[model samples]
Structure formats: C-alpha cells, structure tokens
Target: MVTTRVTWDSLPDSIRRDIEARTGPLSSVEPVSSGFNSELAVVLRSADGATFVKGLRADHPRVWTQNREKAVNPHVRPVTAALRWSIDNDEWNLLAFEHTPGRHIDYSPGSLDLAKFVQSLRTLQELPCPDIELKLAEKRWASYTDSPELFAGDYVLHTEWSPSNVLVGDAALFVDWAWATRGAAWIDPACWVVWLIASGHSPQDAESWAAQIPSWNDAPADAVAAFAAAQAAMWSAIAEADPEPWIKDMAAAAQRWSESRRIGARSQTAR
Candidate 1:
C-alpha cells in the first residue's frame, strides 16, 4: 500500500528543526516521487552536502520498517547508500542516508542495465545474512503455499525486485531494505524473474536471465516451480486487494511464469 506522500513544507516545525539541526539548515529539498513505502522521501541539500531522508509517523502501522532498514544498512555496505543518522521523536521516525544520484534500473529485454543489475545481485549474494530481526521467507509466503518450508534458508534475500528499488549510476545500488528477508539465496533471482516478465520478457527469456546468477543455477527445478506457483498466488492476492493496474500486471506476469514452469514439469515427467 502506498503511503500518502508528505511535502517538506508540511512537516511539523519541530520535526523540521530536528532535521535541520542534524543536516545543518537545508538549502533545498527535492521530494522523491518513486517508491511507495515512505510517507516522507526527499533529498535535502545544505552547504555540507546532500542527504536522502525517508520517514514515517511514529505511530504508523509499518513504523518498524525504519528500524529494519537501519539495522540492515551497515551490513549491506556500498551496494546501498550508507545510513548516516536517524531521528525518533514522539511524532515521527526518520533515517538519513548518504545521497547518491542515479536513475532507476531498466528491466527491459536487451537493456544494458540488466547486466549491471545481475552484477549487483552477485555482489549482494556474497554477503552473509547479518544477525538481525528480519522476516523469514517461508513465514512471509506461508499463506500462499502449503509447502512453506521449501522457501526456508539462512541466506539474505531482498525479495522485492521492482525497478524503483535499484538505481544505476557508476554502479547499481539497491535501496529500500524494508522488505528484506532471510531465505534461500536463489529466491532473490527467482523473484526478479517475475518483474522481468512484467517488463516485456517472455517467461523463458526471464528464466534465462535469472540463470546467470550462480545461486539460481543451483536451485532445484521442482523448488523453483513451486516458488513460481506460490508467487502467482501471492501476487494475485495483492492485485485483488488493491486492483491497481501495476499490481494487476505483476499478477499476470507471475501467473504466466507459473504456468510455464508447470508445463515444463509435465514435459519432464512424460520424458
């Protein structure tokens, strides 16, 4: 669900003062229009430099996402912008990160950004899952599949693959660790396949791209098929609840990939 966006000028005076104290009198504020998770997403510029800030009301239902991002940032180094500071008051909770300028990644077929994205994933896969409180993949997807245990693993997983979550400049950088999870390493690339399909790649082409990731190559065919089916169910529920066009597109992409996997499984069984 997209949080209602709040402008910089609309922030409570106390909150603005608290931020300015840390950032040293903001000279300019650029509201970030991408990503749905934060009520306040902006770039604050001062004589010192720029800082990226994202925050939520202290009492918001998803307030814990702020804590999750803070905890995970230190572990996920240069792959993500460094979290510089945080503020929590009776009214709000916010995190400040080193501002890095970049454009969102393009998942379209034949895009050069695809190779950069895969490289970024390879770098991320090398990092061990830090000992932090995070949602486990099996538990998160349990409602969508009977065999939730198949999704269990100790490896860190950034399960959301939306283009907005990745930025490419000198290098590809991943943001919004809000939905980060602990799961099988292969699951990250598997999740990306659906977004690839949504971006105009056929299921076969998407799988081919995912196969480039080392962990994906190690995933069992049956387990991947199961994951695809579970994802189809999961996205269907999400789209049904929101009825948003983008959500519906993702739901259709997931279903197509799931069906393709089922067909492949049947062909193998016949063989």
Candidate 2:
C-alpha cells in the first residue's frame, strides 16, 4: 500500500532544523512523488548542491527499511545514488542521497534503454554479497516452493525490477535497496524476466533478453523453473488481494513466463 506523503512544511521545526544543519540550510524543497514506500520523499537544495531525501516516521512499521538501505549503500556505489548522510531522531528516520539526475527506464520492446539496463544488471551481478544483515532469498520465497534451497547463493540480489526503480542518464542507476536480498546471481535476471514480459516481451523473448546477463546462462534448469513458478504464485496472490490493473498485468506476465518454462521442461523430457 502507498503511504500517505507528508509535505515539507508538516515536519516538526526541530526536525527541519536538524535536516538543514546537515544540508547547510535548505534554499528550496521539492517533494518527490515517484516512489511509494516513503512517507517523506523530497529534493532539498542548499548553497552547496542538491540532495534527495527519503524517510518514514520513526514509529512506522517499515522503518527498518531505512537501516537496510543505509547498510547496503556503501556496497552499491556508482550504480546507485551515493548516500550523503542519515538521521534517526525520535520523530523520523531519514536518509539523504546525492541528487542523481535521470529519467526512469523504458522497458518496452525495441527501446534503446534495454542495453544499458542489462549492463547495469551485469555490474550488479559481479558484486559479491556484502556481509551484512540481508534476508536470504530462500527464506523470502520459502512459502512459495518446497525446494527453497535452490535460491541460495553468495551474490547480492536486487529483487525488485520495477521500471521506476531504475534511472537512465549517462548510465542506468538502480534505486530503492530496501528490498535487496542475498540470492543466486541469476535470480536478479530471473526477477527482471517478469517485468520484461509485462513490458510486452514474449516469455521466450524475455528469457532471451535475460540471457544477456552471463549468470542467467549458468542457472540450473530446475532452480530457474522453481523460481519462475514461485514468482507466478506470488504475483497471483498479490493481484488477487489488490486487484489493481497493473498488479493483474504483472500476475499475467508471471503466469505466462512460468507456463513457458514448464513447457520447455516438458519438451526436454519428451526428447
């Protein structure tokens, strides 16, 4: 569910002062509306430069996500906006990132952004999972599959592939590390396959595009099949609970990809 956003002026005076003290007296404040997770999302400008701030009330249920992003930031350098500073007071838990300039990526078939997007995935695929507190992929999907161990690995996984989480400028930059996980290197590309399908790629074509990431090629066939099935089930449940058009579309895409993988498995068995 989307959190109700708070305006810049709604913050307590003491909180505003604390932020300005770190940002050098904000000259301008613009609320950012693109992301859904943060109750406080804005761009602050000061004499020095601009900073992007996102936060939740200290007592918010998901406030732990703030700490996850902070712990993961140092490991995910130029591919993500640099973390400038963070604040945790009685009122709020906030993070400030260098203001990165870019538009969200277009995942539509034939768009030029595909190559850059895949390259960014390749960069992420090469990074080893940092020894930090991250949820294990197996545990995350345990309810969806009997063989959750198939998802285990030593690589960092950016499991969410929504177009909005990626920014395209001089290069593709991934944002929102709150859901980052430790999983098989191929799982990231596997996750992207669903979004690619939703963006008008055939299941086969989506898998082909995912093939651009070398790790995708190394994936065990059974593991990939299990992951695909799990995604289909997971998205279907989400769609059923919400019934939003976009959510239904994602559910359909995941189902299509899962069926395609099942067919491929049967074909191999028949041979």
Candidate 3:
C-alpha cells in the first residue's frame, strides 16, 4: 500500500514552476500507484515525452532517501531508467527520470524474466562500486547479526526485492535505488530469495534460483545463514509494527528461509 501520496495539482505553484522549467509545459500527469515512499510519484507528459518524477519535501525525515537514489542512478543506469535532472533547493526536492516503459516483474517459477533478472544481477556485480558513500549492509544489520563482520563484502547491492521495484521491458530494469547498499555481492540475490518465497516458491526453490547468480553460489554458507537470520528478524519487526498483509507474508517467508538454513546446517553437521 502507498504510505503517502501527493497529486500534481496539490503541489505548490513554485514547485510546479520549477518542474516546468526543467521539462516543457506538463500536458498531463499520471500518478504511479506503487512504492511506499515519495510524497509525489507521477509521469509528467510533455511535448517531448514523459518523464517520471518522485520526490519529497526537504523537511521530511527520510529526505535522504532521495539523495541515495540520485547518487546511485549513474552507477546502475545500465539496468535502470536514466536520471534526467534533479531539483534540490530550499523548499522542494525532486528527481526526473526517463519514463521507463515496462510492467513490474513476475517472479513466478519458470518465468522467462528470470534469465534477464539474473543477467542484470551479474552485470551489476561486475561494476566498480561508485565512490558515493552508502549505508553498508554490515553496518545496517549490525544489531541483527551474530557478528557484524559476517556481513562484510565489497559488492554494491540494491537491497529491496519487491517485484514492484523491478520493471520488465527491453530488459528487467531495477527501479528505486533508494535503499542501495554496499556489501557482499551475494546479498541482493539472497534478499530476492525471500521475495521469491513470498511469491509462492518454496524456500528450496528460492535458493535454487538465487544459486544461478555466481556470487550467491560462491558465497560461504555461514555468511548466508547469518544474513538469513538477520533478515528474518528485520521483517518480523516490520510485521509486528504495522501488520500489513504483505509485511506479514514476507516475514513468514523470511522465517521459513531462516529455518530451512538451520535445518540444512544441522544435516551437514550430522553427516
């Protein structure tokens, strides 16, 4: 569910003027009904074309999220919509992006999009982490992990795994880099495993799909288990706080994944 939203007409006249100055006159605005952040998220259609814009007020507590998205855009442009411009002045802050034409990815078992998604992850894994400072996975999950060092790695990660965050077009495009993190390359695929499980795949099936990404395959089992436990705790807290259906489902999926990992480790120990 959209946590907050603002329509084009509701924006201050000054903000509207600033936006029009960047693009041509806005002929139409289409609000996108996805994402929990962003006070505004809409496609502004002009004589030239449509540009997607999502933003929040400067005073908002999570305003840093916009900065995070802007900073990582260039690094992930190969698999993301192009960032055209940004307005980060006194009152309003916003970003305009190349209006990507695509629908949310379908992560069901045997979906054709799986190959493209995996390729995107592989390509992303190869890029040098951008110089921009970001929240490290180890740091972000320090409280949840048995040892923060278990989360260490040098790979950049797009930590969100909601299907809505991905778009299927000429390629599987990952949108919303707001939560991008610097950590083990395998973390993103590990996060996706939870979503895959939430989307109806068994925990075993989810791991199989994740193993297709070489980093995930090469990752140490203990490190992955550490992440699984942390993720389960994180989702459980979110579910308890809000109790949204999606949140609860994902929490359950994460718990299931965590349990499976524990069971597998025991089996190996038994042998």
How would you encode candidate 1's per-residue C-alpha lDDT over 233-263 as one tens digit per residue? 9999999899899999999999999999999
Candidate 1: regions farther than 4 A off? none
Range of the 10 consecutive residues with the lowest summed lDDT in candidate 2: 120-129
**Error in Å for residue 203 of model 2:** 0.6
lDDT of each: 0.93, 0.93, 0.90
What's the C-alpha lDDT at position 4 in model 3? 84
State model 2's lDDT: 0.93
Residue range 128-151, candidate 2, lDDT tens digits = 689999989999999999899999
Per residue, candidate 3 scores C-alpha lDDT tens digits across 117-232 of 89888888888899898889889999887777877788779989798899998789898888889998889999999999998999999999899999888888999999999999
Give the TM-score of each candidate: 0.99, 0.98, 0.98
Compared with the true structure, model 2 gives a TM-score of 0.98
